[model samples]
Target: MTAGRPEPVDRQLPSDEARELLALTRDLVDREVRPRSAEDEAAARFPREVFRTLGRAGLLSLPYAGEYGGGDQPYEVYLQVLEELANGWLAVGLGVSVHTLSCHALAGFGSEEQKRRWLPGMLGGEQLGAYCLSEPQSGSDAASLRTRADLDGEQYVVSGTKAWITHGGRADFYSTMARTGDEGARGISCLLVPAGSEGLSAAPPERKMGMWSSPTAQMHFDGVRVDRERLVGGEGQGFRIALAALDSGRLGIAACAIGVAQAALDLAVEYAGTRQQFGRPIADFQGLSFLLADMATRIEAGRALYLAAARRRDAGRAFTKEAAMAKLFCTDTAMRVATDAVQVLGGYGYTRDYPAERFMREAKVLQIVEGTNQIQRLVIGRHLTGR
Candidate 1:
């Protein structure tokens, strides 16, 4: 069955502006994103222009202050837009999320001069960004990262590798974390390193199971010197900044997960309603009907969970545990829903002539990125036990 654009989620936005923003997001997704997604994925082509288009349209800077060229929308509205984008293409949706995460430190903690100088270009459509946190040796255990940035007179000399960086080679800037002092989490600090720094370079992108249009690679900083002015927050503040960014970033991942699951479910439902089994549409049978029901229910539940977390964040509540819970539940739900969609399509899903297989592959990465679902569980458990 040919996959169609899934129906838009009936989002309960807070204002006319938010409603209009969602409408704009849908229009852009249909006109610019969906048509090129399958082709780009098949060719392993990165859609830099598509991101530039998003930037021009102001989708790039939602959920930040308007004074710094942000859209100034609430997280609830911003996340729904993310869900819609991911419904069109996971790479694009996740890319926006990562870009926003990369901007978090500078936008939230940078000096007024830094904001005045850099935020406009960063938040505007002129530049794309990457978050540099994970390393070859430190994946889930991020606090143990060995990448170092030593103060050398008027600048900091950065040297090390950051692994699994989205937009690694292509980003205009990198919000990098590096050790500046003692050998622990407290030693780490944040820096906004421009992409063309003398010693900064990237390895070839990873050959992944899906989302080939979104590049992931290792970035090398070979004594790359950044001006002292680029340091975000304070020395020894990177770990805290990273964790704060993650709480919101996890919600973005959760929204993207739901979008993928929703797409898979929509494709499955369409196929089931049309495909005949024993001279009758498969959707008429209780077995297939029940499966579709479960998929829809899971998508709805996941959407609600992520939105609840977003609302807490928007309201300035401590949402660390809630964000983790949403990330864990939503990603697990996406994997299940995508698998069920593939099963519903039988042989077609396996071949990827249909997107069910792609959905399944894409769903796997959501559980691992931002933070592993296992890591999410640990975070939730910590909140519960205060341990």
Candidate 2:
């Protein structure tokens, strides 16, 4: 049985406008998203209309520049919106994060002419985007990818396979990375490939552990021709762009993890307060109450960590290490919190009759995607030791 809605988080907004934005997001979630989350997810249906709704409302383009159809909001404000959306439903929220990641190369490094030509429609919300960096052979060692994009005349013909791509078959565009020169990271370059291009096709969607409605599939480019103008940044800059995009993407995952964790905690607290045991509320006991306290404490810590990293990004500071830390700690916290919530619910939590099980399944992918938690630790360690 669904517990009643939890009270809204009291947020400290940067301005009245930001407060209004969050309110709008919350209203949208309550009216349109939360009610159908479980049903849609169970049916393996992607809510494209919901994304269109977000797009039409300008939620999809919040952190980009306003001049090119973006909202120009600071990362701080944008991330809170993500967190709220995730609180209602993880798939929709993480879908938005992936869409934003797909747009990163063009927004951050595209030529002015490129932005003028493409950025508006991309950020306009009518279009969906996907990022392609991981290959079947290369997961963390992205530098060794064999996808090739060789220049011929005025165009580049691409041929390779990219695996574990989100929105693989459904996206309007794919921001792809391919090898254009010597082997390794320096040879890589980014290209924005349009959908329906000849020789470009997607394999069947992978059977996933969670987020079923959000398709993850392999993309194949069989001599898919792209104009030289479609190159983002330049040849040999793809690896750098991918890393930069992931740094910000990790922060998005961190925010989403907190959202899932907060939702689970809310469920646990509500269940404990109402479920009777020994003729008294279970929450009245110190042991169960202490668990709730720890859950809340960890959630706050995760929130503060992500927000601090977001603030650094907003200030134009290097946040690679901080973002890694947030992603690692927050996702780990989500997994622990979700599992404990299941424990708090006793046997009821294990069943799909409640949302706690779903939260646990969804929280798991947060640690794996963007970058694995192990990779995050590696990133932090490298930054710390300069080794």
Candidate 3:
């Protein structure tokens, strides 16, 4: 910022103050993200510049080490930033979440050399990343994936298909989970697959009901070869890495859900206050007011749920159940709140003229991705029963 212009935002982390930083992040989102979202969604196009913009702003890799060109902010603050981003552009938020999932493999399990080689471009957002876990035959049961990466004389010759990949061929690299040993979960091994590797190609983007702006596609790995150095952890530890990523990935989706819901509620409240009904503004109606009230309540509850999970994680506590709870609660709340937001807008909500429709579309994918809300409940239920 120059004279007469607001100061450029400070996204750096200092352990002493979080509220102030989050407010700044919110202002940054209002200034940068909210203004361009409509066009981004309308085109169903990925903004390559947005990634570089976030990279320049130092806003993309919160919770990752600054040494790796990340902000190194705590999860609590990182998530609030994501909330504001999603509230502005769901595609951007989902991209960050998927990128984080890709980073999870390196951060949690990568060798020091691996971290050094890969973390810069990723944490800087100079390149996008995708996690290849789900296949056509397996979504929740990722271990049952048919993709195979067998060792050749000097490399692993990989072959199979992965489905519903967020970045797919568009990403610079894929964090792939493939069968490398015997059948079942124990057989899966995680590997790093570069995009455009020989024999690797992504199918046409999915014709989806929502998240149309976020590219989704099926990946084909036809004899793609990778060196042993590309293996993430060990021969049979793919399931562990996959589950570990999901544990944290669930929080990212929860944050995304809360943000979308918040955006929908805000739009609904504003529309209700200004739109005329009967002889006055529709906000005057008790029925509509109550709907707004419930919307606010649910948004607050969902925000609290995700933040609690974030805190528990930062504290080094066992937080699987909490993360799952946040995912389940926030995603469902998003669906309910988005539906209500549409109702508040009447026919306008059902059309592209307003964002409520898009919000609703984006909300559905949050529930389906990361883990289905049903799967989230099963995770929590299992923990509750001490299973």
Q: Between prediction 2 and prediction 3, which has the larger TM-score?
A: 2
lDDT of 3 by residue, 96-134 (tens): 888888889888898899888878878876777899999
In candidate 1, the residue pairs with backbone N, CA or C atoms under 3 Å apart (3 or more residues apart, or in different chains) clash, namely: none
TM-score per candidate = 0.99, 0.99, 0.94
Each model's RMSD to truth, in Å? 0.9, 0.9, 3.9
Comparing candidate 1 with candidate 3, which one achieves the higher TM-score? 1
Report every candidate's CA lDDT: 0.94, 0.94, 0.85
Model 3 Cα RMSD, 1 decimal? 3.9
Minimal lDDT window, size 10, model 2: 1-10
Backbone collisions counted per model: 0, 0, 0
Q: Per-residue CA lDDT of candidate 2, range 296-330, in tens?
A: 99999999999999999999999999999999999
Candidate 1, 22-54: lDDT as tens digits: 999999988899888888899999999999999
Candidate closer to the true structure by lDDT (higher is better), 1 or 3: 1
